[model samples]
Target: MKKFMNFGVLALLGMALTFGMTSCSDDDPDYSNVTPPTVELAKANISGMVTTIGGKPIAGAEVTAKLGSTTLSATTNADGEYTLEGLAENGTYTMTATASGKQSVTGSVTVNKGETAAWNTRLSNEATTVSVSQTEETSVEVVTETLENNEEARVTTVTVIPAAAVEEGEEIIVTPVYSTDYATTKAATTKDFMLMGINISCSNPNAVLKAPIKLTFDLTDDVIAQIKPMKEVNGSWVEAEVTEEGEKVVFTVDAFTTYSLFINATLNQNASTEAISFAQAEYDNLYGASEMSVGTATYTYKMGSEIGQHSNLLGAYLAEILAQQMAGSTVKTVNGSYEINVTLPIGTALTLSGKQAVETTSIAAGSTTVSGKSYGKVSVTANTYNRQHNGGTN
Candidate 1:
């Protein structure tokens, strides 16, 4: 009987131990004291309206915003309104708006976290009204009037459109688009010249004329002497024959695209002749009969055997002129780049090898190559003197 009592006592001890273990197992870990990981939420948005300079709503305009590799796009509604959502907050986006029969516009906007940023784009289009009749030729004037910084000026461009250029009774509109963005426009031309005219485009896309259209610009004699009429062909500016008649400049265009007056000058004013010769020598040595690699394409720049070949010397002279023009500006090397301090108009940009510098407080800085030569740094600032007009009516 004493041995059976001891076995019962041992069984009771085992039951108590098992119960203690069961109670411990039932309790969960204290995860309440641990912190949770953070998750970022996209709460920023960009919304805007795309309209013409006259405040006309542009329907079917494609609006795109780019931030790094992320691109968000939207189409404008009938009201010309568009919105891009779920963008990262506090990020700046480069915005572009493009529509048929309109000049594409580009700008930038910064959106804050949990907020919608408003960015409006005003596209430029044909400003002149035309009524095509059964006439041999029609003449229309495109006028650009500007009142900037309390200063007012007017530019009037006259184009003699031949009847063969457009269909009879088909309305034609021509608009002279004025841009102070010299840096951007300068890239289209191989010449180193200051833009001092307007870019004129017709309402008709890719309109080629059976007969040459007469274009005229009114300007001071001094200005006309320094300017040349250029027409954009195949995305490059080629000099068109220009003549000074009284206080006006005249040129003929067989095709209507972007036409402008470029201020032509030699870069080495003191050594113009010698500079031309040296540049021609360099061109012959570097590019003549040899393939020059640009990006991924190789091009052979053929030159005539003449001493003053137009194409060969043209590129060199223009490059020298541009270099001389910027020589007076302040230059500094920053982070192994050339930084040039130049003052331009408010809307203008400083372009180096097709790369534009970002503007801040009227100052823009960038680094790029110029004519196969790399610069450590370069910059441009807004010219406080707003009266120095490069091109356009105002």
Candidate 2:
């Protein structure tokens, strides 16, 4: 008898996906204005067989694939097959294959340059009981029920979520300007600026089954401006304004990095929620930053059409570094604002480092709670080859 295990969406898996980026130095200057290598193309092939506890192929089962950094979908065919094409790089790829009830799976794959690889998966029996569990910046574990015949065909799946989710809110980008000469006079804003539509992923398969997620902001930018500052000019306090002349300023914001989705997993006969929670917490504390900063955010900024294309979040950080690298640069301070962005060396990495905590094992065993922390160092590196060719050399 073939045992059956139905792990819900495999969101809490702690898999490491490394992005190999080469950094450039100003000393090794090219000066040519070269265009950095943008995502030229991207593609995906999703093929999977749908089966029941009774061992029969179910036609027309839905299987969708998400391309690098985007939430768009490419679904499977009537023959239980699917594929996503037109991806650019031959880097690490994250995929989620799903069909109703049959445990959904999310995993990472390496797609070689111009290569059309095959992604074949098998769907298991539908889940009997809906349950949920979570681990902070670590990993999420989910187990499924055994086959009716008492065979052990259980599946425990884990997926890595961004560390930011566990901490507070989705990651935000802020821009502040500084004077080329006087770096101490912090710049000021007259109005409250808004950078909206920030989206975060829930890496816990069980999270979706539990409750909707919420992230609050609490970030400070010692380099740029977070909250604008003002002083009493003529007996009345008013916001300071930035004239054509530059002023030094710092900025920052904090928010939830997870989504409104929930996860629900059950404790099947073969699997324990305790084991899963522990594994996830450890993983988050170890590599959550790397996966999000390097894996998800970097990938999105480099490829996606949303915020990545408009705001040079990475580019802005690079610009700050560039300012820092110049001779005789200094930082400015604001009176009322807490967070700010300071000028830093161009092409220098903005290390994003932090940590997360494990929620509770009790939640997995029928309780209604999930928790954890998300921490790490998020640094941005400039494209060396592109800078050499484009930054004036060309």
TM-score of each: 0.42, 0.23
lDDT of 2 by residue, 209-231 (tens): 12322222222232133233332
lDDT of 1: 0.47
Q: List per-prediction Cα lDDT, in the order shown.
A: 0.47, 0.27
Which structure among the candidates has the greatest TM-score? Answer: 1
Clashes of 2: 101
List candidate 1 segments past 4 Å from native. 1-85, 88-94, 97-122, 145-151, 163-171, 180-207, 225-228, 263-394
Clash count per candidate: 14, 101
TM-score of 2: 0.23
